[model samples]
Target: MAPVRIAVVGLGKIARDQHLPAIAANPAFTLVATVSREGDGVPGVPHFQSLDQLLERGPAIDAAALCTPPQVRHELAAMALARGTHLFLEKPPGATLAEVAALQGMAQASGATLFASWHSRFAAGVAPARSWLAGRRIDRVQITWREDVRVWHPGQAWIWEPGGLGVFDPGINALSIATHILPQRFFLKSAVLEFPANRAAPIAADMHFCDTHGAPIHMDLDWRQTGPQTWDIVVETDAGRLTLSNGGAVLALPDRTERDEDREYAGLYAHFAALIRSGQCDVDVTPLQLVADAFLCGRRREVEAFED
Candidate 1:
């Protein structure tokens, strides 16, 4: 099969650090063009100031990866899907569930592959953890995902905007893994979101959830951590304790441990290529749904203003 000609939209930090390298390494994909409103793009590849310009005048592409902020993803994704271009959406697929659903419908109508990618789910330990817990009786689950936003997001002002999702941006990664690994479906019970006095989005959240079989699930998410970052999940089951740390890159079972190099984005690109070839769409909104529930029932608390 020929390599899929692909364009990468949004020349942001993630696009530069993860997506570009993944595309370059995957023999199944060939870089064709790029789009960014700030006049940023790859050196040799065709660069467009907007997706409209890319579609109108840039090189033809079979697929596009949307790496822009969540607030503006819907319009960009819709344009590509309408043109029968396969799409790869970064985490927090859209600002809202309704928009993502609409895109899924568009993909179906156009016969284009729509992948709402959860990169964290592709972490090496995630698959193993899911397999190990499949048959065991889940007793309880705990998730702690804390990191310094200044380090990760830097001066990305869009993150604090209304549709940006604030800390849930990273928190949802944990949910993606949990939703995929757990044996039963889970729903949010209650939540408390802490908003910095000056920002439109919350800086931290404490949420409680429960699975169908009554297994209690607790989540603590914060963007204020300054020291070593933590992205860890601990689950207790009939067999024993299971731990997935380092953002699902390391797994610790009762008797053994497993760890591997990072390959989340690589795995995502591979899956996207497969979907495009098979004429299929992989749009799982479970993780995004969980984030929506957190905002719906969550009590809001105003805290000290955060300065970036």
Candidate 2:
């Protein structure tokens, strides 16, 4: 079978760091072209500055991975589906749940695959954690995600913008993994978003969540930690305590013995390849829904100003 001819839209930080390298290493995909504002050059692939230009030169491309911001991805996804190309959307599929639902409909109508990928769900220890947690009764959960924006984001200014998602950017990965490994789905019960006084989005958020059964889940997201960054999730269950740290890179039991995993992007590409081969679409919007709900129902509080 011919490899899935793929194009990547929004050649930004993610596309450069994770998607490009993964595609290059995977035998199931061929990186054909890219769409970005720069429109400069990328090795052997044709590059277009806009999605329209790339779509005009489409058809040879079997699918397009949208690495754009959540706010603008909906329109690009719709266009890709309308043109009969499959889509792979980066995390937090869209800025709104309605948009993702609409894209699902478009994909169905066109008989195309729409893969809303949450890379963290594919972490090496996730499957094991899920299996271990299934038979146990989860009592409570806590997540702490703090990072330095300067070191991680550099000059990326959109992250602090209204649609850019700020600290929830990394925070949502925790939500995704929780949604996958936990036995029940959850809804946000209450949330406090800390927006920099001068910015449109929250720089930090403390959220309270509960499942239909009332199991408690608490999340703390911060972008101001200067040293010893932390990404950890602790779940207390009937069987034992399960903790995944390092942004899902490491898993530990109560005794603290650790197990490591491959990078998440690699697993994500593997899942995409399997989906394409099986003629199926994998679309999950639970994580994105939590984000939209946070925006709709969250109490916004003004905090310190953020620079860049």
Candidate 3:
């Protein structure tokens, strides 16, 4: 295989720390260009200010990996798909489910492979957990995904804006894992979104969910925790108690420990490569649908202004 020639757009923190490094490490991809407004072009690669400019001047590329915010992802994906370029979208697909659905239709029409990259679902432990939980009755599920925004996101301004996803930004990762491991379709029962007085989006959320069988599930998300970041999910089932922590990178079961280091982005790229090679488009919007459902049905409550 002539390593898929690729370009990366939105050279932000994730593109720099995760996407770039993963592309460098994977032999299946070759970084050929970049599109960014401010980022210094990746070494030895052509950099364009926009996708239009890149398509007009950059080298022939096989695909484009978009690491931009969800607010603009739909437009970006449409642009790439219109050009018959396979698209790799970073999590949350789009700000709204409707946008992602539209992109899916566009991809089908253009005959381009569209991949909604959910890095968390590729975590080392996720497959194991999914295998064990198969055909088992889930009694309950609890998710605690709390982290300090100051420590993790630093001073990103967009995170507090509408469509920036705020707490749901990280919480979606948990939902991706849940939707993958549990076979049943879960629906949002109720939710309380706690928004900071000064921001347009919520800083925290409490969501209650249940499956078709009425098995209860709850998730508590907070962006105010100042110490020892926590991202954990525990599930109780008739087979055994399984726990996945560190954002689905580790698994603990009653029989034995199944632990492995996470190279989530690398796994994601590998999967994307496979999808492209197989001429298949993988666009699972269930996780994003859950987020949309939360937004649609959630009751908003005002909280104290959050500050670093």
Tens digit of per-residue lDDT, candidate 2, span 1-308: 88999999998888898999999999999999888887574876888888898777654788999998887888899988998898899987887778888998998899888899999887777877888788688899998999988888888777777778888888889889999989988899999999888888888999999987788999999989998999888999887899988877778876655666576888888888888777788888888778878888999899878786
Q: Model 1: clashing residue pairs? A: none
Query: Of the pair 1 and 2, which is ahead by TM-score?
Result: 1
TM-scores, one per candidate: 0.99, 0.95, 0.98
TM-score of 3: 0.98
- lDDT string, candidate 3, 108-219, tens digits: 9988899998999989899999999989999999999999888878888888888988999999999999999987989999999999999988899999999988899999
Top-TM-score candidate index: 1
Show how many residue pairs clash in every candidate, following the order shown: 0, 0, 0
In terms of TM-score, how similar is model 2 to the real structure? 0.95
The C-alpha stretches of model 2 lying farther than 4 A from their native spots are none
Residue 46, model 2: lDDT of: 87
For candidate 3, give the lDDT of residue 140: 97
Residue 211 Cα positional deviation in candidate 2, in Å, after optimal superposition:
2.3
Prediction 1 TM-score vs. true: 0.99
